[model samples]
Target: MNEPDVAVDEALPAPRPMPHGLDPDGLTVGVEEEFLLVNARTRRVASQAPSVLAAAADRLPGLRPELTRFQLEVATATCRTAEELHRQLRTARGTLTAVAREHGLRLAATGSPVLGRVTPPPLTDHPRYEALIGQYGALADALSLCGYHVHVGMPGREYAVQVSNHLRPWLPVLLAISANSPFWDERDTGHASWRYLLWSRWPSAGPPPRFASPAHYDSAVRTLLHTGAALDAGMTYWDIRLSAVHPTIEVRVCDAPATVDEALLLALLTRALVATALAATEPAPAIPQHALRAALWRSARDGLEGMGVDAVEREVLPMRELTQRLVEHARPALEATGDLAVCTELLDAVLRRNSGAARQRRAFCRRQRLTDVVDLLTAQTAGATALT
Candidate 1:
């Protein structure tokens, strides 16, 4: 049953004691990818999630969660190194692709397929999602709102929070680089990532300020609960924030990356970014929110082709230039982890031509029909298609 649109709130899951200090050597990376369900025959979305889940239970390992009947979330095992991260992502994709094929379905990677509508069957009966529907009601089940979540294990809660504080200012740059959602409900939304707008609506979403300390961060979360500002500490979906459960800071700005390389580039960059911030003597100075948001808008509207305003120096920088600047800026930190080469090689490709969304648009224009676009999107998500 759907909760009324009227005001009603429910208590959140209980908070537990925080974890220990950050571990520099104990590197672990985890990824949770969300996808929309689509019919194999039509390529249009079908709420065929429950049937697919049941049929493919043996295929999926322990980490898959059904967000809705048509929506699925698959997580990678905690990777101890970059190679492990790559392997886990491939395994998750392979298993999910095989299962989807068995059920005559395809998983889509785009944040919101141009043709998606929020209507879809609710597959899971879990209280967590039920509580979600009951609380937010219709607003919670937006089917097109797809995303990719990457968790970088932090040294500890305090360092995670500290990194999160510094990371918030740069979250928009990540979003700009990763903008891949160009259409909604099968029509052009005129924004590279309409999904970003949807995500920003949630109370806990968007960039957060620098927390004073890990202890201060915890106290603030507690205060949010006591004041009714948040349903729980988990709701603190700050664009960049320390995970209350995991010993990591979670970055939530990116739309689900279309290509595997895009995903890996983001993952590597995030690790380098965090290390850079943590080692710095003073907090990274904040970027002007207005300028950052405007750059984000340009990035979403035009992807890498759009020029962004430099909030720091107050000038216009070409998207390609900004991207280069980011790589150069993070060279020292990436070098620390020896992932600088990975980042440089990936950026070379992204800067040259078009992004995933751009290529998808080109394909759609080639066939001049929505069906063709669906075929393209389905292939990318299913891993049967390739741009590599």
Candidate 2:
């Protein structure tokens, strides 16, 4: 994408006032998880989102359409506690699974299609989506990606922007843990999270710049908009960003995890990370852009089973070490929120399995059939069984 020569002083809305006496540990958190609707018999993505969504119309506001007709998204209501968030996610997943079954489909929470042909799925019926296809042809066609997005409440946009800086170094680690897209189009992609690589094709996607201030963030966004790299703030697609429609810092680093327990782990750790950032007295780490990108690639390529780069130190280390560092860094906040024990248990479970990617690979290796992978995803998505 070409960078447009635009004035940096574009008028933008003033930042809102920071809330007084805000408690970081008590901040509300929510998640929006995307899933692929799969044909139960064929084990292929089914473009029945329109009919399925209509069947689930009563679950509106919580359940919504995605960029592709094969994709559906479910969002949790703002939750004050980790357990409450877990309940919401479980209920949402269960309800959606039932609704999809009613339409002769199954909800697969894997990040990408496991057993389908690599054909362009139908675009959702919306003018904005049509415009996207018109603007970015092939990129729009390969939009069958699913993600687990976490929103951590912030005091204001300015604060959220600052929190994003603190988030950059840890983003890769989170991606590694939630890496679930091992197979695509009936073949292993070799990369754990193929979704991340596919998503990076977007002009405005991936790690965001480290802004010095809220104005700097706005200036950078204005440049993307002016250059048409991004259609609007909502399209910025940064791994971390100030939510365009909510008073929260949204983290988009993770692919949709295989199970609700995995999703809860991401949410709890993310909230704790945000709380840690809020309490920090030191400035955000000054990791270089190249180092950050390298770290992300390493995470996506290896998931939690290989070496990872410590962006801050610019040194490669075992991914397990990086994950430990992440938990340690966020320990105080985790304890403050009374989620440390549950987070520890979830983290232990994930590590034992290696990652969602590893679990999928294990399933595939068992029968050497992608249908097994699809079955695993379908079963897990419906809360019928776990990867173990």
Worst 10 residues of 1 by lDDT: 3-12
lDDT string for model 2 (1-388, tens) is 3333223233323333346788878989999999999998898889999998888879646888898999998888999998799999988888889888998899999888887754666888899888887788888756899999999988877788668878999999999999999888778999999999999999999998877666778888888899999887889899998887988889999999999999999999999998888777666777777789999999999999988999998889999999999999999999999999999998998888778899899988998988888888899888888657
RMSD of every candidate to native, in Å, equals 7.0, 3.9
State residue 170's C-alpha deviation in candidate 1, in Å: 2.1
Off by over 4 Å in 2: 1-20
Candidate with top lDDT is 2
TM-score against truth, every candidate: 0.86, 0.94
What local lDDT score does residue 257 receive in model 2, on the 0 to 100 scale?
Answer: 92
For each candidate, the alpha-carbon lDDT, in order, equals: 0.68, 0.87
lDDT of 2: 0.87
